[model samples]
Target: LHSYTKYNTWDTILSWINSIASSNPSLVSKQVIGNTFEGRPMTLLKLGKSSGTTKPSIFLDCGIHAREWISPAFCQWFVKEALETYGSDSQMTSLLDQMDVYVLPVINIDGYEYSHTTNRMWRKTRSKLSGSSCLGADPNRNFDAGWCTVGASSNPCSETFCGSTPESEIEVKHVADFIRKNKSSIKAYLTIHSYSQLLLFPYSYSYNLAADHSELMSVAQGASAALTSLYGTRYTSGPGASTIYLAAGGSDDWAYDLGVKYSYTFELRDTGYHGFLLPESQIKPTCEETMLAVKYIAAHVVFSQ
Candidate 1:
């Protein structure tokens, strides 16, 4: 029952994770993939049954946009729920028996902390660029897929600023490297964001449909329907560019490019009344509903194979 509104600080989040890992070493494994430009450690937690060699893996990431506190909270909640219900709940136990869940609670630690300490709306990594005073690069737009093309900004100060080069930000590089290393086992890649209520799939760089468009749309619709069943939260599902605003170089698209079959970007919770300021009370229900969607997708991934 972690509160996102109060625990938005990076230090507190990291400390909480440390405490969990310390107490439950057998269930939680922490891995530091890399360091942010501001020297904050970019950590990931791996959760699953202990005695499996080749379980299918799903990658879940949150807070890539910095101000999306609810996004990261959901990631943390997913980890806890998975660990708590592993052998007791039939669905969770079955999922864990077949798949390993990798959760990156906060992808943009520097920007997330900056949002807590200085600004309430920061959306990028706090990386200083030469010849400009504006800090940070949009980690979402820093991926290598269709780099600097449509739905991205070149100017350093823009909210959608693509970095000077693809994978320029250490955060983006680290995630890319981790995905690459686990490419064989990963079946789904989910990046959680806030304020839009969208379940978006690939080919975000253009209007052209993905080769697996029909199958992707089917899973997206199923996941969306599952969420709606829980809280009547309706989500528009389609290609990222068509469903929402198009943004080039997004992790979802990049993961698709890297051969992860089911890549999605989930824009969670309320649709802009609260916007980035999603309340703590909604965290539990949000995570619970989103978990239904996640399980729907995971079950599909398993059954299809």
Candidate 2:
């Protein structure tokens, strides 16, 4: 059992994924989707009851921004809980029986390492953009939804830099490519971020609403209610741009645009007392409530299908 009491390094997290997959051969497996600019492997954990045919899937990726340590912790905790409770927990059992989950535990491995070793607040990929002195671009802003417009910055040094072009960050590109390739099978896209308890959907790039706005809002409201019922962790659920900021090129919006109607962005935990430095003590409770919210969405996906 990997304790959620401490933040592990990139290598240690990878080890946990590989070890869990090996130990639970029938329930979980992993694949190296792509490599970061610093040569770190971007691994995805595939969780499901072994079945030959494809099932509807929900893709949950965490730690896209490096400083948000708790995001990756949730991913690890969710995986452990999913495997441990598959037989005992009714919701998890039914979810695994009817659907599959693919989790990218640490998407920005290079930047995560940098946050641990050098800067304690690094939030971008470590990729050195050509002809620029700045070392990285915000992976969130590197998606194709709105490219380098609106809330995104054009300067490479800015924290919200959208990069030279869409899909400029290799990490973002890897996720986009994988989702694009698996778009048909994937019914939901859940990307986890932090420092604000929000359950957001598409149209972060524009004020316009998603085509499936009504259904998405209904499900998100139900999931948010489920999450709050656990620990009273209140989450405002709505469109990303309106609920949060107008940050464009988000993976949530991109995935929604790619035809994954259930795309969501979960800004988890505190509204900013701890910010990116969320303590290890809060990990278990956070993960517990978050699991409820995630399962709620999963149930909705399964039932609706």
| Best by the TM-score measure | 2
The residue-level lDDT of candidate 1 at 27 comes to 72
Q: Residue-wise lDDT of candidate 1 within 1-305, one digit each (tens)?
A: 33543445788788877777777777777899999899989889887766647678899999999899888888888887887888888888888777778889999999999899999999999999998899988898999999989989999989899999999999999999999999999999999999889999998988888888999999999999999999798888999888787679999999998899899999998999999898788888898999999989988987876
Off by over 4 Å in 1: 1-6
The per-model lDDT (C-alpha) reads 0.88, 0.90
What's the C-alpha lDDT at position 98 in model 2? 89
Prediction 1 TM-score vs. true: 0.96
Candidate 1 lDDT? 0.88
Error of 1 at 43 (Å): 1.2
For model 2, the stretches where C-alpha displacement exceeds 4 angstroms are none
Give each model a TM-score. 0.96, 0.98
Model 2: per-residue Cα lDDT over 179-253, one tens digit each = 999989999999899979999999898889889999999999999999999889999999988887798888989
Model 2 residue 262 CA deviation in Å = 0.5
The CA root-mean-square deviation of candidate 1, after full C-alpha superposition on the true structure, stands at: 1.5
Displacement of the residue 65 alpha carbon in candidate 2, Å? 0.3
* Leading candidate by lDDT: 2
